[model samples]
Structures are given as C-alpha cells and as structure tokens.
Target: MMFMKSIFALAAFATAVYAQSVTIAAPVEGTSVTAGQNFTVDIARPNTLSPSQEVAVVIGLVSCSEAPFNGNCASFDVSQIFGTILYNGPYTPTLHNGPSPDFIDFYQNFTLTVPSWFTPGSASLNVAHVSLIGAGPFPDLEVKNITLNVVAA
Candidate 1:
C-alpha cells in the first residue's frame, strides 16, 4: 500500500510540472486594424518551466469562418490562412507582472503584414504552441484564437 501511495504522488507531481498554456498578449480581442498594414502580435506564457523545456509558437491569421471556430485548433490548417507563419520559434521570456501579482509572464512578438487581399471585416488570429520537453517522442500543443477587426488600408 505504501508503494502504491508513492506512485500516485509521483504521477500527480509529473502532471503539475507539465501543465502549460499560451495566451495572446497584444492586438487584444476586438482590436481594429487596416489591411496591408504591418501589425504585431504578442504571445505570452508563464515563465515557470526549465530552460530545457522550451516552447515554439506558430501564428496564423484567418477569417473567423475558416478557423475551427470551435475554440479549439485540433484540426487547424496552415494553408488556409491569410497571414504568414509570422512567428515560428522559441518564446522570449521577459519579467513582467501578470494577471496575478504572485507571478510574472514573458512574451514574444511577431510582426505580420495583413495580406492586402484581406477583406474589410472581422477575422481570427490563431496560434499553435508546441511545448518541447527535454526528452520526449511527442510534444504537447496548445491552441488559442482571438478576433480582430480589419479595414481597407
């Protein structure tokens, strides 16, 4: 019974250590912009993981109707988006007070030129974050979506 208890404890600890998430820190929800203009998207996450456990983020801006639209990107298509993979690298962690004063958050910014072909209307900015573990066959992924208003430049 004692050995079983130890195993459970270890499992819980592992789960907590692997808990991770990603958030859109800029061009906040409902933000308005113009097509053919350069815009910056800031992606943020908690700076609570070890250096070996690095993260990579891929950003894509698409029409709201084109996204999974279910608040999940389990089936997102990189080819169906308007903006390019504006960012595809590790998140640059910085020290800043976050939602809770108890902790700090870091972010990486990506600049994207809103495609000139984009129509004047609403759109969705989607991101897929892959948490790369020091040693693992499969990386964990977290997806997020934010809405933006676009107008002709």
Candidate 2:
C-alpha cells in the first residue's frame, strides 16, 4: 500500500515537471467570440535542433462542451497555410549549441475562425500539436486547454 502511494506521488510530480516544458501564448483564457470570429494562439517549444528539421507541425484546434467524444467537439484542420505552419518558417535561434543554430519555436499568427455550428455558450478550446513527416499524419500529440465563451452567429 505504501509503495503504491509513493509511486502515485512521484508520477504526479513528474507530470508537473513535464508540463512546464511547453508554453502557450495568446487567446487568453475566457476569450469571447462570435460565430466565425478569428483569433490566434502562440505555442512555444522549449528546445529544437538547429536548421529546424523538415517536419510538418500540425496544430489541432478544437472546441468542446466536455470531453471530445462523438459530436461534442469540432476539429479545425489548421494543418498548413501557404507552406508555413502558422505563419513562420524554421530558422536558427540566436542561442546556438556547438556552432549550429537552434530553432525551437512556431511563432506565427493563426486565425481560428469559429465554426458556424459551434453553438453559443461556454466551451473549451482544446489545443494539440503533432509533428509529422510528409503525407503521414501519425500523431505524437501534446495537448492543453483554454476556456472560451462562444456567442451567437
């Protein structure tokens, strides 16, 4: 019994530590929107390799009343726009390691246009990111949430 408790405690601590690795900016919690209103969110990756690997970063923008089950949530295919993920491309970071540049972020302004079916009320904006190779949408996802108030169309 004691062993199980200790393991649970350790797991909780590890989750807290891991969560700090990523940060989200913009589209502040409780952001208000009407039908089809547009907004942006900035997600920062703590570390990246120089010359940024040629991989596609897919952002999953969704809205839900509860858990994303059945038709409860609506997904937006915010995959790629104009050959740019979000709006920016990979470049070397000022802070480099071993003479190679470090590209560690997806800094872009993406407009999240509320879907017409997103009924007016309180909903959660679920954020997810996955890195992919060409053509394949294999998901290695990390997710977060923000509160929102969706208004009428």
TM-score of each: 0.69, 0.48
lDDT of 1 by residue, 1-153 (tens): 999999997885566445556688898998997888999998877766443354677777765544354443334553455354556676665667877888787777788788887766667777888776433434667677777888888
lDDT of each: 0.69, 0.48
Q: Which digits, one per residue and each the tens of the lDDT, describe model 2 over residues 91-132?
A: 222322322364444344456577766667656555444443
lDDT of 1 at 58: 77
Model 1: residues with Cα > 4 Å off, grouped in runs: 1-19, 49-52, 65-84, 99-101, 134-138
